[model samples]
Target: MTGTLEIRGLGRNFGGLKALEDISVTLAPGEILGVIGPNGAGKTTLFNTISGVFRPSAGTVSLDGRIISRMRPDQIARLGVGRTFQSTTVFPETTVRETLERARSFLTAHSPMAWLGSFGQRAAGHSVDRVLKRIGLDGMADSEAISLAYGFQKILGIGMALVQRPRLLLMDEPAAGLNSSEKIEVTNLIRGIRDEYGIGILLVEHDMKMVMGLCDRVQVISYGRHVAIGTPEEVRTNSDVIDAYLGKDHELA
Candidate 1:
């Protein structure tokens, strides 16, 4: 069942550098929340903390009221949280089926061969097929994931996360490095995830159009702190947000 992801007063430090300080947001089940900010705004740090890649220096992260700040990444994933990174690289010669199989296998405590002995293996196979079809990759299941086009490779990353059947999905830049058509495809897919599967989504993306149009609510952060949180319209017009994130060109110096 879907549950809330609560990050209260979340803080992270790199020795003396504060990456995130007092960052907070409550992502209710089935809601899509956007975390957008300019360069060096701690967006990645917050995601790393929530996904258990980094432990918070202070505050708490909870799912269904259970504290999860100190949990391992694999452990957190099994608790109905799945994440896709900013980039994806499939193993050479590995088919799409194999890629997803590995991701799903991570949630189970059994070896893949051992898992096949259980009655659940049939169900697992079905899940793999279902995900491939859902992501529009069914026809290419036997094809190498590395052989797919760049857009499909990115979508495959999302499918890898989906086979886990997560209640909440952490997506990093879902629309990054895509052509216009691919961008539209990803936008629809993200919406379908929320409306069809009822999964809460937390995404960090630089694509303002996609984020502003798709998210139920938007959260803006800067310099390790949350600057604003509100509906799309509210966030678009917020002076602080415009000045802090949207107004600034984050190109490398």
Candidate 2:
């Protein structure tokens, strides 16, 4: 079944500092939701809470109607949640195929032994082929990951996630370091994943053009508070959103 993802009253603290406080949001099947805010506005903290990298000091996280807040990172991942980091996390020494092959171990099994057997690599080979085709990297399967262009490496990150066949993908700035044209290409590929693969996407981006063009809904946070949530047209005109991004130039709206 296509799953539902929900975050309710999620909170996180770093001793004296509260990184995220009382945050809540939901994502439906095949929806692309964008989260945007200024630096230290708690964007990544929210993602960390959802991905089980940090347990909330309070509140719950659910997927497909099941409470998963207490699950470990791997457990949460196995439940069909995939996440990409703000910085690329590829193995610089491995080939493109090998990188995906490593991801397959987690995607295909629930036990560590399953990852140790010969079948892991065999199954990984098949999964890698499928993801390569999906991400348009089939021809470069044997190329060293360190040797690919920066944009292609980013695409490889997406391809690695695709190999897992996750129901929900948490993407943090997929277009962070690309040129204008490259950003457009990445945007189209992300849209394809939602439309063609039926995966729900939670996109955290600073690029307004990409967010405005690609997201079905945009959620804006300021000072760790959700200041606005609406369609691109609606948020574009929101005063709080304006002040956060454009300050006095907000009158341009």
Candidate 3:
């Protein structure tokens, strides 16, 4: 279900200040687009704008050419866009299976308590089992959410989103706070999602190594503006990107 995503003339303002400015980018079906910027460079703001947390001051966002920029977050989510927050979003008290099943229930026809009512435990167990297998969490299905490692918890967030079978996933720092091995696990997981489920990804991350290693293309932002957009090699060699990250590391470029 992955399809193209287009952002045109996207801008967001906070009273006197502009958080994002005329940002435009496109992500093709089944492709991973990396977004990188220094702090306060409007990276997360752009994610918020696309994800509908903030209505853009101007412009349009489209998935498969369908406008969704100003839609409600839930509405956007239902239309095949799923997102994982920067911080862990799971409820610590819930079991791994319960977490994803609850998200699926809310996203579709069922309610959280519906599992307890008409469907009974049998149906609920099936639903939870399906999502756990989908995200490689089947082994931890019975584990408490609070008991899992932070990395798995992050994957569980993704599992919750996957239960909705979203077409485009906006991941905020998917590798943040992870050790090298965990980061590798996340990178592979992202690729597996794209390869197996046909989901396109828009990754907002600070791990330049991960971004450069995993992305099909990249967009760089500095001061609320896109300074470069291209292949990993092209962006890595760009003078502006070198200046933004490298400073005198431009010598390496």
Best by TM-score: 1
Candidate 3's residue-wise lDDT over 114-135, tens digit each?
Answer: 5466565566567567767766
Write the number of the candidate with greater TM-score, choosing between 2 and 3.
2
- Lowest summed lDDT across 10 adjacent residues in model 2 is found at 244-253
For all candidates, the clash counts are 0, 0, 0
List ranges where model 2 is wrong by over 4 Å.
85-89, 109-123, 246-253
Instruction: Write down the worst ten-residue block by lDDT for model 3.
Output: 244-253
Error of 1 at 155 (Å): 0.3
lDDT of 2 by residue, 95-147 (tens): 98888877666556666557577766666677778788878888998989889
Worst lDDT 10-window in candidate 1:
109-118
Candidate 1, position 102, lDDT: 83
lDDT per model vs. reference? 0.87, 0.84, 0.83
For model 1, the superposed segments whose C-alpha errors exceed 4 Å read: 110-116, 248-253
**For model 1, how does the per-residue alpha-carbon lDDT over 75-189 read when each residue is reduced to its tens digit?**
8988888897456655777999999988787777553445456666777899999889888989999988888999999999999899988889999888989998999999998
Better of 1 and 2 by TM-score: 1
Could you arrange the candidates by lDDT from highest to lowest? 1, 2, 3
